[model samples]
Target: MIILCEGKHDYEFIKELISKINVKCDVKDQGPRDKDFIIGHVVDGKRLSYVPIIIEGGKDRLDGNVRLLISKLRSVHGSSTWVLILRDSDSNDADSAFDKLRRDIVSLINNPSKFLLYKPSMDCGQGIRVGSFVYYDCDLKYMDGVVHFRFIFVVPSLEVFLRNYEYVNDDSRLHYAIDKALSDPGIVMQ
Candidate 1:
């Protein structure tokens, strides 16, 4: 499984969650030095899963990063891989962000009709919306084989979700919110 997210904060937040879950994962720096891509592997019984939580630097780079990563993973892992994209809604609502991301991904892949689209649905407790699309059977034009793409939108932003407060415009405050969440394991339950 591959997890692609929006920045250092998101990357750290996810790394922390995986640690809390007792998953045996090792974080390693992958790709170019300028790009922040972290790779980890989770051992589940006899199976080992490559879970790369890639930081695309910012939301603006998400579309291109997704396209590039998916294409590369298709060549390597093929139908065995599953990708999960995590991003914040920021100024937009969750539904709008989900729609935009879905469109962006659909536009990137070849023969969008071959994949089965799953509409976004709310996870009421977390206030997050999730959706996915799956490609099955033989290889296609751009894609080598089957692949699963799933996405999640953190309502408004990660800081808001973590702090349970209104959106903070300042970058420092956003970092502070993430820092606080890192210290409080209880924040994950809330």
Candidate 2:
């Protein structure tokens, strides 16, 4: 599984969330451009690895980054990879944000016929809203086999999401959120 998220804050939040779940993982700083997060856990005594890539350039670069990452993964892992894209909806509505992302992916792969678009369902808690869309058996051009794509959109941005959980304040500083999560592990459950 490969997780693609926007910015360092998203990466940190995910890293902290995985830690809160007691999942053992290794994170490597791939320098200022991006971070390589390899989340490993033992299941049935077997270890599994999930790689997460952070796109510091934000949403505008998502399509290009997705193409680049998928191309690289195809060479090593072949078509047997699951991609999860995490982005903030920002000012856009959930549906609009999802549509824009869907369009971007469709354009990226140039396989609209094999792309199955589904309306993302919204989940809300304490004024915090998020949505997700899953594309199963999606075909990527130049890749031999099918791939699965999942897009998760956090409404009004991840900062708001963290704020609702009391993990960050109005400013939503990276250290502030990390400190809150470190202090209250139960925040993950909420």
Error of 1 at 25 (Å): 2.0
- Report how far off residue 27 is in candidate 1 (Å): 2.7
Query: How far is each candidate from the true structure, as Cα RMSD in Å?
Result: 8.2, 8.2
lDDT of 2 at 44: 19
Writing each residue's lDDT as its tens digit, candidate 2 over 12-51 gives: 7667766666566664323324422222121112224444
Kindly list the per-residue Cα lDDT of model 1 for residues 12-116, writing each as its tens digit. 767766665656876432332322222222112122344566677788887678655543443332334456666777754666666665556556554444333
By TM-score, the best candidate is: 1
Let me know the TM-score candidate 2 reaches against the reference structure: 0.58
Report, for every candidate in turn, its global Cα lDDT versus the true structure. 0.52, 0.51
How many backbone clashes are present in model 1? 0
List candidate 1 stretches off by more than 4 Å. Answer: 29-50, 76-78, 110-144, 165-190
Candidate 1 residue-wise lDDT at 52: 60
Using all chains and alpha carbons, the TM-scores for the candidates as numbered come to 0.59, 0.58
lDDT score, residue 145, model 1?
41
